[model samples]
Target: MSAATTTEQTLARYYHLHARLYDATRWSFLFGRSDLQARIAALRSPQRILEIGCGTGRNLARLAHCFPAAQLIGLDLSADMLARARTHLRQHRSRVILRQQIYSQPLAPAPGFDLIVLSYCLSMINPGWEQVIRSARQDLMADGLMAVVDFHDTRWPAFRRWMAVNHVRMEGQLLPELQTHFQPLDSAVRRAYGGAWRYLRFIGTPRPIVHR
Candidate 1:
């Protein structure tokens, strides 16, 4: 294989090797994930839901349980991750589509989705998340729900902030180019652990469409 292909293969191997232990080891570091699940459940009318960075498809499986009839699509940059996800989703018996792609690229260009979720994703992508969000906005249907669950600057009590800072220092290196991308939308966060950590959730409502 070519050098680039070889490198990609090596990385995929590394991810697959670690995939089984990923949830147990690294899952707790991603806090406030339950909040995302709760909010998606409350949407009440989501039809087509898209999940970016769907590693191992655990969340997609959870979503299937939450909304039995909705169409689900998951995208990720690593084929190894997608493979694990497929295995987890094999018995769901729902229409779950998995795509191997990075969030830096445009979505499938299929107009839009009823619900779009970014859960602990931006902090691990290439330096184009803003572009990705713009693409998501364009790919959303009118009044669609965009839910984000991610680590934040964690403004809270003194001790919690210190812990958050340290945790970010450890894992944030993987996403060194990521910026605080939550300011534009009307956003709120639930702060805990002396305010050292928070989970941010934002929703945007596009202007209404008028039929000609």
Candidate 2:
């Protein structure tokens, strides 16, 4: 099997096992999610929003509250995870749509999203994280936002190795790559657990392509 396929299957299986415990367990370490939401709320009143790794839909639920008129889509890869998301987002079920798919390509009908969010997800996608970022740009409107909050890096090799086992790659790479595809409106990197690791929060619009 291709390395990417292996990575996808491994994560699907991992989430299948961890789906039930995700919302409960992720509360402590999934930092800056609510903060990101609040930041987005203050900055934009998007009519349509998409969360790339909506997981158990906790973020989606929050977005629904923050943007009552917004049409929201929660896109995830694992059925088990989306199943949990469905239950978690039951109150806003009518406005929220959930899909199980890898986000390698732009969504059809062209640049439909007003805002696209990547929350603690790009780190887990091994071989194709950059592609996902680029594709999300293609999936966004000319005037659109891309908001991200995710692991930045680790100073401890042991901690890094442990995270790798859990399917996360935190080498402080995502933010720079995101900047390549989007222009920064607001961005920050913060230390986690007394600098043992770091995480980034960013909100940006698509970088204009300069024709030569």
Candidate 3:
């Protein structure tokens, strides 16, 4: 299947059907979201924020708490997910915009967004996940920050091996794809504050090529 088609199918199968159960299961498999949140709180430029693959708006809700003054945009490919997000966000409807669309490309160029966050959303993409990260790097403003927290294979042999096999059997997923996707991006892997989960956070700002 083409990238677009696969994107559509993945959204429907995983996000649409799974969105209602997302936050319930989130703390189980998605362990490092708070690490992403801390990085988000530190951003100073482009005060507006965008969250790509914002499943069920859980992160958006927390982000609103952290940055109440920032305008929020949440986009997801799953209509069902958006439905739940919409309902949850009604109280803050004026402060939020939810779009049912894929983030395979850069969003309509907006000015001065302080931050764009992707929280545990990269593992599901079959391909072009790297491209999405790259596109986000380009779309950022000079001082804009991009914060991402996703699955990572810690350099431990036994636990790494166990998580790899366990995830596929349990959730039909694995982190190697995302590990490979982010390998070339300017980023680092830090141990999460909680006990077991390690976080992969990358920050990018537009760097102009200097003429010698």
Q: Which number leads on TM-score?
A: 2
- Model 1 C-alpha lDDT per residue in residues 38-80, reported as the tens digit of each score: 7667655687888987888888888877888889999876777
CA-lDDT, candidates in order: 0.65, 0.92, 0.66
Error of 3 at 40 (Å): 2.5
Clash pairs, model 2 backbone: none
lDDT of 2 by residue, 1-212 (tens): 99989999999999999999888888888899989988888888999999998898888888998999999999999999999889888999999999999898988858998999999999999999999998898888888999999999989999999999999998988988999989998899998789989999999999975557
RMSD, model 1, all Cα superposed? 6.4
Candidate 3 residues lying further than 4 Å off, grouped into runs, are 109-112, 154-198, 209-212
Tell how far residue 148 is off in model 3, in angstroms: 0.3
In Å, residue 90's CA in model 1 sits off its true spot by 1.7
lDDT of 1: 0.65
Quote the positional error of residue 22 for candidate 1 in Å.
1.1
In model 2, which regions exceed 4 Å deviation? 210-212
TM-score, cand. 1? 0.72
Which pairs clash inside model 3? 45-114, 46-113, 46-114
How many Å off is the CA of 209 in candidate 2?
3.6
